[model samples]
Target: MAITKRGLVLGAAALTVSTAAIAGTGLHFFKGQALLQSDDSKQQVADADKDTSLQPMSMLSLQSFFNQSPKELVDEVWQIIDRTYVDGTFNQVDWKKVRNEYLKRPYKSNDEAYKAIREMVKKIGDPYTRFMDPQEFRNMKIDTSGELTGVGIQLAADEKTKKLTVIAPIEDSPAFTAGILSKDIILKIDGKSTEGMDVNKAVTLIRGPVGTPVKLTILRGTNQIDYAIKRARIEIHAVKSSEVQSPQGKIGYIRLVQFSANAPTDMQKAIKKLEDQQVAGYILDLRGNPGGLLYTSVDIARMWLSKGTIVSTKSRTGEQDREQANGRSLTNKPLVVLVDGGSASASEILSGALQDNRRAALIGTKTFGKGLVQSVRQVGKDSGLAVTIAKYYTPNERDINKNGITPDVEVKLTEAQGKALVANRDKVGTLEDPQFAKAVEVLGERIQAFRNQAPRAETKR
Candidate 1:
């Protein structure tokens, strides 16, 4: 019998499979089995009637055996976690015991097996690590595609209040046109109470077929407002820019909502247009920006940084991977970054790189401090797993996980001031936004200092 390299690899992987070990690794068991080829030349490896006992069979027999039970599907999830979880020892939990406990319970259906799998993953105590069902996985795909059928608003839950709050509405979206402002508390969605509702669940409820309307009960400060927003196909523009005349001269203002697939390209065009207009300085606003793709963040960082480590990742075996800038500096203009509590993940990566390299001055409140990296892999044809594979650090080797990155100039926003800023965000040259106003002031001083320090040329005879 001729054994192929792929067959050998599959056989080795199957040999390592044990009932006691399984859970946090990124493994696609269904897909792996589908890749293996059956040897038609061989006869029946095992007869069901003759052997009723459990025994190791040929590669082809193993595939057939694995498909008969949903328990094997659960075991695949467990084994992946056992081998590839961020913590090698399952965070000191009795992983084998946990596995046995789940196995002991009879799973009558595939749903029960999925529930068991979720319960096993929750034991790891990492919120970022999660098992996504088919619907949840589909929603994730819709979010990343930059176009979705929904009201079109970014949302975040308050840590203290646990209330679902609107981060920002996409420009020209139904939510924005319906007057959904940042910091607005959503009491209910489509008459469904939002109390204690997970953000993802709420999103699922809010999104529906285009042309349908979703009713939202919003709490703005002490007053409550109701709006019926019709769902539409929203195309999110991750980057928005404009040139504003400031106290010094024309300053480039760019607001980065999220580091989506189109962020780098959109930002590149924004920067090029601003530079062409002869802007003296730039302010990159990341306030209320819930972060997105990691590679997009790194690509954006490379545009500003001439040379330095952008970000670093540390894995379970103390393996460290560093992403450094590619020595590409697009503009020498004085740069200032604006961040707040809403900024997270890839936002932190970009801010940390610029601040550590002394390329930009960070101004505003602290960041959201989500420093873990999640690798999403398909479990079966429908489901998937988003596992936290590593913890990331800034260029200065600072791990800002629970503790966020503090700004050089700390400016707190009062409740009333926050409401006013959201209302006037579209008004250009409006100094009512104190944080942005302060950024413009700081950049003005830096630009003036640069001009004064420049060596003047001598007048020719």
Candidate 2:
């Protein structure tokens, strides 16, 4: 719809002219109606005064405003946040004042508008809420779909040292093939140092067109090694399943790398195949999973949970959404979940839900606490914003945000042991893996206890 005179003149949205508009139009007003410097603006204003339709260039179409003034882009993002932002205080930044301040700036280019948006997002004091440029937006969508064109290494900054660290390499991707183990501290991408670099910036630096080589300077322990790894199109099979023979019985082992859209389907197939085989127990390994779609996690949660709340999202505005299982679980086999520092977001949600509901025994170290929910919204023709919309809680109403869910049985791996296991990925779910070994032990104990109680309960009844 075309922006009418009232919409532009009455400050429905305060928009300013970009440098491109100033270069084209001789005289143009930015704050109010975009009046031309010539007598045409006067005539148009006079026409409005005479009670006729005020037809200025801005009244042509809103698209024209979008093309000429990047300030509209600013307002476009501003309006979305202003309307739907869960945080009433906008993370304690005066959101109203921020809009006016940014709108007042003469945006020289779309980049300038994007910069303003970035700074504005930063003022919200949320690291998760960020502006994604066109390329980043595209990559983010691809990432959630279990595909991406990059080195295929998930990265995060150390909470204490704040150094850019590798979470884990995507299985069979370029980084994984290059032997880039988990917990490898990235010193630099190409030649630039990663000091004070966030994950977003590091990602921008590391990723490029497929087949292109991106050199990474990695600090593993005290040794500094340079890896010239070529980027590739990574298609991640997030769920992998196998049957392991153990003392307890045949174990259905499933490793979930990330909660991509296909996770639920894949998980169902895996569980069904294992159930048909009559596996005594199941082991869900969510180690090094960076997480994906929130709904995908909920869907997977339903695959295991027969009933009870799986997760709940509560916005700052008190808008709450709760998900519950509907008795569609594939099997009721004794279950154990494996987690570590890399298990984050959806991983935490799934693990926390299972742990809280007593559906599974968690056997691993603490999880990587990232509980904020983000909504990916398009800003304009291109570019997007990932704004934090809510914080999720487990079935027990535990907010596992920064403080991750502690496992029922802590099987912590030391730095060396963790590095070795990551180096030899084949042993990840086997008895050789200390964490997996502990999971087997815990599952055996639980299975024995259940067996011990079965006869006594039956006789009493």
Candidate 1 residues lying further than 4 Å off, grouped into runs, are: 1-69, 143-145, 153-199, 211-230, 455-461
Candidate 2 error regions (>4 Å): 1-68, 143-145, 156-165, 177-187, 195-199, 218-225, 455-461
**What are the clashing pairs of model 2?**
none
Q: lDDT for each of the candidates? A: 0.67, 0.68
TM-score top scorer? 2
Candidate 2 Cα deviation (angstroms), residue 181: 4.9
Clashes (candidate 2): 0
Write candidate 2's Cα lDDT for 283-352 as tens digits: 9999877675565677788888898998887777673668788897877778999998778777888999
Across 1-461, the per-residue lDDT of candidate 1 in tens digits comes to: 01111111222221110000000111111111213222122222211111111122334435643354557657766766676567877778988998898878887877787778878987876555666666654554432325546777766555457687775566567877777766688999878899966555677778777898889999988998999989887666788898888888899999987665567878889999999999998999988665665666777898888789999877687744677888776887889999987777778989999999988888899987767765555454455566566778998989987687999888888877865655665652357688888888888888898778878999999
